[model samples]
Target chain A: MADFFQSLLGNVTNVTWQMAVMWAIGALLIYLAIKKDMEPSLLLPMGFGAILVNLPVGSEALAPIKTLFDAGIENELFPLLLFIGIGAMCDFGPLLNDPKLMLFGAAAQFGIFFTLSMASVFGFSLRDAASIAVIGAADGPTSIVVAQQLRSGYLGAIMVAAYSYMALVPIVQPPVIRLLTTKKERLIRMPYEQKNVSKTTRILFPIIVTMVVGIIAPGAVALIGFLMFGNLLRECGVLDSLSETAQKVLANLITLFLGLTIAWRMQAAAFLSPQTLLILLLGLIAFVFDTAGGVIFAKAINLFAKKKINPMIGACGISAFPMSSRVVHKMGLKEDPQNFLLMHTVGVNVSGQIASVIAGGLILSFFAGLV
Target chain B: MKKKIFAVLAALLILLTPLCALADNPDAVETCPPMVQSQLEAAEGSITENAEIPEAPEAAEPVSEEEGASETSPAKGDQALSFGESLGYMLKGMAGIFLVTAIIILAVVLLEKIGGKKKDGQA
Candidate 1:
């Protein structure tokens, strides 16, 4: 009887302060997910997985999760597959209607390169610095792929920073946008001119994008190819059911597993470090600069453009998707209730998605051989 | 319609030529400088040695440049480039992104014209 009791209590004594801290962090993430609705699909699983992995159990207990991580994340399969769904869900009509908005997407990527220099200055190795800088992509899959490809030591921190900042787009973007633009600039509204984009154009957009991106940055072919493929599935006119499954079922399934598997790196020993905190701070700086870059680019364009663009719409040119667009749209509505910037912001937002992937590819091309 | 198709095909062919060349001769791809390669090899060796003997969690602190200096080559530490070099890369990367964006925008504009023409013909 005593032996049985001892056996039951044996693991309890093994719990350390770090494990307790991880548990708290996990619980906090769960709270944020449920209460704040901050990327609940991902954060909740990541939170629960953090707790599950941080338990004082033996290595055998974590074998399954380790297997899943190795199979899904380490091999870079999940993120690519997730891209298919993302591509399927996207409606590029807004962007097609106004292709010039793509420049905002391009300009917004300035943060990634800026952060790369900053990370390098801060004494991180090139591969690790590049990986950390990709957090500015405001993209989870890109961050994961870059970190994995570069063999960055801070994969766990990078993933956490990327997703967390992506979720915090609503909170992170506004101040930076406001700081850069005046109230008058924010109020400057350009009327939306809806252009009829034909069926052939819709189908060809993905194909042309894939080819162009592939030709320019061969390293990004896989990432861009998979993304455009998903878009192709959506725009093909005959693959309606497949497109739906890709957007809903496949994306959800991968996200659920991706979130949980990410916690394998969130082990107390790996995650609890000074570097993790630095990574988070750097991630925030990246987001700030990305917002600044987009707003400044817009302000510059307004110098020559006959019709002024509401600078806030430029801030939507990060890969946080509809969230970044909605934030800018809401801010526009707040400034002038009659002003609706959703279409414009959505155009820039989708363009940002493509731009972020291209940025990721460029980073890989430039640094893959070096590190 | 034939002209538009020919234009697209020609553009695709032009774009595809380089990829085909690169695939045919992978050795043509650029590699790291010899100095950087040597440094990376040394760093990898040290990392492998460390992996042989697992340390306690407390030892898992961030590897400072000074700490890694012993394993790194004398010319440059574990960093692939200095701050100055990274700035150069930044300029190049930003230029590359803008260039690609410009090309894509041009392509979209051309496609829109073609699509519009087709729709008008159908009507």
Candidate 2:
């Protein structure tokens, strides 16, 4: 059986320690992604990609994988294209109604900078730390944007870490929320009055924001513009079918491709290095700090607010989008069934997504100047 | 209580200046090397500073709000990479995130649409 396997590929007798370890790690990620249903779309593909790289196929025929790596990832194409689908999926209505939630978005990015400094202290170069700090975004687009701009060699590891942490957002955020806010604080229900936003406002919201964020950060134009474009399609009232396509068919198909492509980046030798482990650790730090900065900022706001804002929603300030928002809403419900922080949390959550993207673009622009 | 809520909201909005403050123009792409980046990162902090209170609500005033944000920021390399290559990387990095988010949003929208008690007739 071993001889036959070797004949089909390479010599099983020549299996290196690195390849063996990589195969194990790949298999484990597959188990986690599939069996545990933990980010299966990405992990399954990543696991598959990992397995292929470790298959020991000789000759230049299998060089296509390497080509895929050089062509798409090296140029940062995939991350930007996926933004369109993400924008289509994102509903910024909650945020538009409550524009102040943009503060939470800005605050949530505290972790990225804080972690960048920490990563630097821990021996990573500036660009590498910047890439690693994006894991705090808990939003893959932001991470990809930052990493691609940073030219970090471990884009795959950084991506995997970001997605895994995001899927674990529910688990990660609640503990942090609890640690920061007392039960009374969580129970502090703020009434959400749904504003009857004008159709004009909805239509103009994306355009206006694109103008605003674009002028401030031109690099963010691609991300914020596409995202707002998707939102514009949804609310334009003229392109219902287009909106539906962007949200459903177009979004889903792109997601499938995005998942497979990211998985392709996870070569064992490149991914399983000491740097990969460091990237994972730094990613976690970025998240923790992002949560801290957001919650702390919210608490600071509460000190000055007359209506007693819910600090829990502040934690949702991270760019994990609706997941962070949902976590806050769930926590609110746990504290008081009457409390509906969903809209408010969603407001902050969506804003965080926008803010993170802008933050990402800013980081890219910031780091781009270095070289 | 309602008044307090209003007051709370008003106060919270006041602090929101900082949020708008931190969000300078995002078009800046930081892809410079280590040495040049450290200098650029230092400049990034100032852009946040200059990103102070929104001066003009007019969407037309683009660069005026924060010249420092873009004035000194690094420029993107002029590369004419094909759109296909760009699309693939975006998907690879973001497909999982969008998938999960879409599933959740779909569920929420579905629940709100189909399961909300009878229109204007609920208990």
Candidate 3:
């Protein structure tokens, strides 16, 4: 009877305070996911994975999660898979209507590089610095791929930073946007000029972008190619079912796997540290700078343009999808009821998706060349 | 013809000298410098001695490396960059990404122009 009890409670006996603390974190994440509905798809799996790994075991040999991480995250197959879904869901028509919005996408990525240098100042290694900096991309897959590629050893912290910052975009962006721009600047009204994008152009845009970006930044070919392929599936018209499957089934499966596998590195021994705090703090800084970079760049363009551009459109340039764009649109309305910046913000938001993938590839190739 | 014969003879002598030295000194290859020969001999001796040693019972090297990396703290030998150098990298990286973005924007503009022309003609 005693032997049976001992075997049953063996893992319990091995529990440490760190493991207990990690469980509480996992519970908190679960609560947020369920209650706040804050990125439930990602946080739920991540929270569960954290608890699973932190369970006190007689040995450090976590089996399936570790195995999945080695096969998926380490090999970078999951993020690439997720990109297909992201690409399929992306509507580049708005961007096509206003091609200049793509520039804001580029401007927003300034925070990533800026954060890289800042991370190094805080005593992170080159690999860790680069990984932490990618949280500025406001892109989950990009953050995972870069951190994994660099072997940053802080994937758990980095992933949490990227996703949490992404979830908090509605709250985090407004203050930064308001702080940078005046109520007058925020109210600058630009008329919505909708252009009829041709069917052929819609199809060709993905192809041309894939070819051009792939040629210029070969390292990002998988990410760009898969994303473009997904977009192609959507734009082609005949592949509706396949596109839907890619957008829904493929993306969800990979996101679940990506989240859980990420917890392989979240063992309490690795996750409970001061560096994690620094990473979270740095992530917030990067997000602020990203917003500032876009807004400032937009303000700069107003100098050359005959008609002033809405500087809030710049904040939409980060790859938080409809969320960042929606925040900008709401702020525009709050400032002046007549202002309509949804289409404009959406255009810049979609462009940010493309720009971030290109940036990720460039950072990888650049650092690889540097080392 | 005499000049060609003299040139051929000189080439033959240059190539054969090293072969002759090797044949004379069987202990060492003529091409190997003294330092290289000593190092090679030492390596060969060590290899023979190590072949007898049972691989040092698979030391704790891998374990130590894994623990060091997996720990939340800095790895054992990890080094941080100076602020100036980090800033330099950040600027260079920013410049490269922006350049790529510029190229993408240019491509989009050119594509739109051409595609627009085609659509206009079709209309």
lDDT of 3 by residue, B12-113 (tens): 444433322222232344247978556544644432232222222233356657777652433321445556655545554554455555555555666777
lDDT string for model 1 (A74-144, tens) is 99999999999999999999999988899899889989989988898888887888899999999898899
Q: Report, to 2 decimal places, the DockQ of model 3.
A: 0.19
Candidate 1 residue pairs that clash: none
- How far residue A115's Cα lies from its native spot in candidate 3, in Å, is 0.7
In candidate 3, stretches whose alpha carbon ends up further than 4 angstroms from where it belongs are A58-61, A369-371, B1-78
Measured against the true chain A, the candidates' chain A TM-scores are 0.98, 0.93, 0.97
DockQ of 2: 0.03
Better of 2 and 3 by lDDT: 3
Ranking by DockQ: 1, 3, 2
Best-fitting candidate, scored by DockQ: 1
For model 1, the interface Cα RMSD in angstroms equals 5.4
List lDDT for all candidates, in order. 0.84, 0.66, 0.79
Higher-TM-score candidate of 1 and 3 = 1
Q: Answer with 1 or 2, whichever has the higher TM-score.
A: 1
TM-score of 2: 0.74
